[model samples]
Target: MSEQLIQLRQELAENPYVTFDSDGNGVSRVLDVEWDFHALNQNKKIIFFGRIAEKYRLDIQSYLYALMQWQKKNSSSGSHAPVNSLIGSKSQLNILATRWGKSEFSLLSSEREWKKCTQTLHGVGNKGTCKNLASVINAMLKAGLVSRYVYKRDYIQWAQPDAGNGQAIAFPEAIHVSILKTVVEFVETYHPYRHQISAAMEKLYTYQDEMFNAKLKELGVSALSHMQMNSLRNRMSRITSQWPERKAIPNFSFHRSGVWLGTLLRMCFICVGLFSAARKEELLSMNKESYDDSLAAVPKVSGVSTKGNKGERICMTWNTAPIAKLALELAFDATQAARRYSLKRLANGYQNGLLTKDKYDAKRQDLESAFVSSDIPYDSEALINKTSLKFHIYRADDGFNMKEFNINATTEDVEEFDLLNPERAGSLKVGGGLPKLSPHDLRRSFVVFMVKNRLGNILTVKYQLKHRNINMSNWYANYSELARTSQLLMDTQLMSEFNEAIETSAVDAWDEIYNVSDTLSGAEGERIAQNKAERLAQGEEIVMSRSELLALVRSGDKSIVLLPTGGYCTNRNCERLCSLMDIVEAPCEHKVITDKAGKRLSRERDNLIASFRAINDMGDYANELILDARKKKIVSIEPTLVKHSIPFDSFNDDIKAIWS
Candidate 1:
């Protein structure tokens, strides 16, 4: 082997694709060419295959590069990007390698070579995979693994893909409200009789094996016999009859009972997803011990953030609504038998030496996951199938009686619902197939709802969604498309609320300017004060009320365009494309300097005076023009400070000494 290959091997050995949880427990490892994110609950393996001429070629450079990237992601501090993203970039490189008929790293010298290899590859026409491909190549170049002759600018100029799937589309407001209402009603109606429902499910679980065998024994049989079904129904009915609120129990059949339990479990998932804005993997990562209601007022749900945390099982907690607490509790109760079965099976597997210590520990950690899918023979595993959850969310309409749920809808909600769904609105039916919903839709909708209702902004949504930055939160909270189609925009009440919120924001800005100083400077500031004084002299109110200020804003008689330099630009139509930070040089007539702006001016004046003193001390005679300009700038700043009653140290004596 070459010396470089040997060195690469050593580096790969030192930095294997392995990661640990927050507590330093081993979570995942890459075995040879396959990475098993076992503890991460990722069922799939990210496999690396490098075959050429019908022989397995161990491309040590590519292998080491992939390992290093994975290490960078799953670092001790925290992950910067997800493992899947790494897998995706690697997969793109793999595709390029396959097409080029050689290792991709060896071919990265020029743009022509990259284009020649990637021209025929799928998705190369778009910037999505192409950008990712370029990123991988750039990383390789920067790491010195590739030729230094390659131009970084060649690949760095790829424009962002215009047609890529951006943030998930938020659900329509009517559908969003209806889904929440249905789930809430389900929780309210059934949460009281949870113990009885658990008992019934437990009884049904015991007979599941017998029922399965009976159906299997009879050829062409799709379901249990009528007599057998009735027997099971009667058994569960006996448990339901003891409920104090008997109305809580829906009309029960053996099959309907199972459907009800399944619906309840799925509803719990929906409730937590909608309220907490957690990702699907995070929600599925939840266990029976996830919900902490110790502080009843501030309940929290603990889950793993799989996106940015590499495959490390770091526990992240989200403060959730009270309804999430009830939903989690119900999900725990409903999955009790499944949890018991998984634990029993895990114990047996370990005792029989079928599972190693590492495997046993990993399985044990996931034993109590809140969502579980078990078979008739009692074999159970964590629920990770996203399609099953989507189907359940689509079928959620069947879980509740629409008539009962709609009774809680307000007149505005009803009108909005009717406008959105005219076909089934008056009948209170959901026959016209429900809109496709997903876990991500719930998260995006949560952001939109919070921002649109004026309950929060991108920062608050960032906290709720656990986004790494405000950019991502802003993407999720983008509701411009939804607003165009929403009935709320047409409703007078909603328009009024929107207007009030805008007016309140404007009023707060005005209050900051007016209340910051007794007197204001700048031409517009002087004009505004004169106008108010004239009104006061005419027997009008001396102090403007919030309502009057709002009217002024509404009438477009005054406007507040805040500048970055602690001032307001009151010019409604000055039409100068001016840089906000260039206020010192290009001062506009519409600028109004408040006390805050005066303080800023004071700092500028102090700095200029200090510069003049430094020039005088340095005996820099050639900088005489510079000294004169600084002095003039200071002279201009002092008047604003004096007018606003802001304190400043006078540098007139120093200026006189310098000139003399």
Candidate 2:
């Protein structure tokens, strides 16, 4: 071994491959190399070059090919980079043992013997397999028996790890040789490496899983169960579905129109995504100002705008230019409308008002906004202190407000104009506000259009979607394709249902009737007056107005207030309740134990006192009232009685029949 090393060192001194002044060093490469030969000598490093040294008898080309094969088979680093496994000489030697057809490399003899029957033929007993194998191969290679074939693991080729199909057999060299050849060829030719992509995604997912597992374990849980995985499954499903479709570029301008705001917004978002692909925060924070100066110089726009900071080589397809043009126009229109509204307000002098400009109005009034109100041409100088003159008009004319105008429009004038042309607003139904659509829908529609058009590079498409990775971008490509193929739009069934529910739940009418009861002189009114008088005599007051009284009587303030005993309000100190009438206006199931004067139960007694026991059988509305589930006592109560006065017997009886 010493003689071989001496000869090898002498040969290395003049060998062109070993002596070249690589990396701009004046010294020969052999002397300049930072390779850990000394570390190898001290049994601290594995010299991987040793494996194929004497395995084949051939010329340098054959040696190179064989070395490449060996590297391909053994290398774990995905790209052409070596990873430090820190395997010492012993492990390399153990690997060499297996390569040379050794049965096992045992570090612990007693344990090795104990598990001999269970061990496989080529399995190393955790002894110094890695280091020993590397050292042996490297030594032979140094003696000129083999050439080093430097290669990285073709992770794309070996997408899935071979776990050897459970049925054990001797490791086959032929299979590895064939695989190595294919891996090398595949790497040389760029192709869609589905397996490799899947592997990378899996590794990332595994890392995320590990982090979550650590968190769960720290919270005193063992391995996660199916329930926990299921909880996250919905998000995972979305991610999985999204992954394959991210990289498809669609024709963003194909569906350009006056009505598809959702489509337009989607295109703008995608353009923003493309420009600011790497900065998620910046992309999200982008506003009209982002496009000001950089794009304003172009002949298409009138004002300066700025966009998020993007790299210089932000590639845009020809199709993108039109979409960007439209986006800028919309942004300019919004900015202009806002500016007009602000100017009108200033023209009228300061007055308490709530308008669209208020949300982003922070700067000094001197700095006039480039974008002004939509009515800049006709009513630029006019001012209104409320939502808008148009919104008022809509309320008066149509009897309902359009909600979309609230989110996107500057004033009532804008709302009225939009509603007047329902066909222009994508044939949206006229009654409700803005047709239940959102700006995000436009983003989706734009991507779909882009996919339909096939207007950008695959990579460009992915970046345009603002995907964090190529995999995500690829997934978006798939989604774009699906959207184009399907031609679907936003589903609005739920929105319609929601509007219906809001209108039907009209408890406010009861409040109105009670409001006028204060001036009543009829027989029923006299009865109410008498009730108020009796309540006042007992220290209770009928302080609530007629409208308030009716609301309390007919409707349950389900969210804010509760009726404890069928009709009496439980919170006695609640100012909303009229303590004068003891009529409380509202009904509740709770009450305080009172004295002869009908004053509240004492403070000490109050602490001990509680309303009649109530049990909600199911859902939000209380159906059954039980004193105690174990006792099965019949609780009794009157709907209008105070909560505390209701007996458990009556309380249970009234609720039992309804519940059962």
Candidate 3:
């Protein structure tokens, strides 16, 4: 490790809070250092040996540097690049400076001094500061940048392995199925109507364009193409992919308002997200034109937003509700309406409020693009259905705002709102005072439902969950509580079956009871398992006599009845292996038949006669042989039918008819 990091580690190990938790008897558990765990200084975070630096993919050096910068100047690393994002970059420089005196990322002099200084970063309530301190210092060591190793052994002892799903940070919850259902209901109840731009809005955009064009004409300013507008907007918006370069567009004041459209589209996104499990970024990236409306039963949605393209139709009869599809339809309409509304608003602005004939003729060239024609009037029907409208559920001002919908509230000044629209926010507030649920949680829950509902086989569930490999599918299956419970239940049931077999017949039973004790909440499964084990241990022959077995067979306790002969082969096309009797030939009384056996015997007799008649048509000689064969077949069926008390009058009549 680098010299700086080695010294930093020495400093961290000396901190009082870095010690492990212990009990009077022994070590109880690792105390604190949890991902969410905090310390005393409200502005700084506590770093410990057990912290997993790589969990958040943080660069330790940058984070430590940022923390030092913040401690010294109350400012971040001043990289003004993505590196500034390591930690504490979003906070006020002055506020950070107020918390800790100026500091530098340098080697420490002594253990006592290091420990005293580290107290500032240790056990701090402000996780951001703690993380910054932890990560940056850790990164220096991780990169082998530490030089001085005065306390290397102590440092090694302090850096313990992480305890569990270590650094347990807050992730979005799996939006409960019940809450999701209510949210859907809310959408349906208060969905906004499609946006409709008034005539005055058209005049506003048109006039604004004219005022700009007139000044440009006086100065000979060339007309800007639509593509150029997009380029200018993008260029002026962000010069760098960092906090420092953020700038607002110079020319733009207000584009247009589509608040209703935003609200409606949010519902659409939610519905699609629940069904398809689209991440916020993926859902927003979807184009209105991308929806595939074809295919029977479940219409397919291609590109349903994944790191890879697994977006085939997962709309199985079980996993999805019909409302999600309806929501998609609504989303499409909302998208179209928003576009129509914005374009018209801009066009109207260019034309001004006044509807004059002279303005249309004079500004014919510039108006030709968005307008219907130079001389033609604005057609509301055509305007809405215009082939060129592009509305991409982006943000409230333009498209959909996923950030707003997902967040509980934006700021204090603005009114907090949701479909639930709870007042004074106590309970029943959507995404508020509740576990935060992300799109991935919805996905995990979806897999759980697949196992719980038994909606699909393993392969089918895998396909629906859109897993790339069977290993991942198996991993998810392991995640299912229902699946785990089912395994326990099946094991218990098998033990019951085995115990019964051992009692009625002689066989060694399987033991292995204690192995599954953890899964068996109720002792019944364990008891059953124990019974079999005890019998096996006793070495007692558990077989019953033939009479007992016969009696047991007649007891109607089992599903498939057993007989001395082969099974009641209800298959009419059988080879007659059971007691050497086939359905076409005869019935075997010893057959372990179904209740439908009586009907089979009756069919056997008629089939015999039919064959006899067909052979008789050939000649008398052939008929004689066929008659003999048929007689034996009829005789075999008559005995079984009579034994079972299945009326044989029909068979008796058929025999007479063939002879007569």
Top candidate on TM-score is 1
Give per-model TM-scores.
0.58, 0.19, 0.35
| Per-residue lDDT of model 2, residues 168-207, tens digit only | 1110122212322332332222122323322433333444
Would you list the rank order by lDDT, best first? 1, 3, 2
Which 10 successive residues of model 1 have the least lDDT summed? 383-392
* Lowest lDDT block of 10, candidate 3: 35-44
lDDT for each residue of candidate 3 in 9-126, tens digit (9 for 90 to 100): 5554533232122221221112333211111111112233243333321223233433443343432432121212322332322122223342223433345545654544333434
The TM-score-based order of candidates, best leading, equals 1, 3, 2
Which regions in candidate 1 have their CA more than 4 angstroms from the true location? 1-90, 93-113, 122-126, 139-162, 210-262, 287-289, 292-298, 376-436, 480-660
TM-score of 1: 0.58
Clashing pairs in 1: none
| Displacement of the residue 226 alpha carbon in candidate 1, Å | 22
Clash counts per candidate, in order, are 0, 110, 44
Which portions of model 3 miss their true places by more than 4 Å?
A: 1-103, 106-177, 183-263, 293-325, 335-441, 456-479, 482-660
Q: Residue 416 in candidate 1 has what lDDT?
A: 49
Preferred candidate (TM-score higher): 1 or 2: 1
lDDT of 3: 0.39
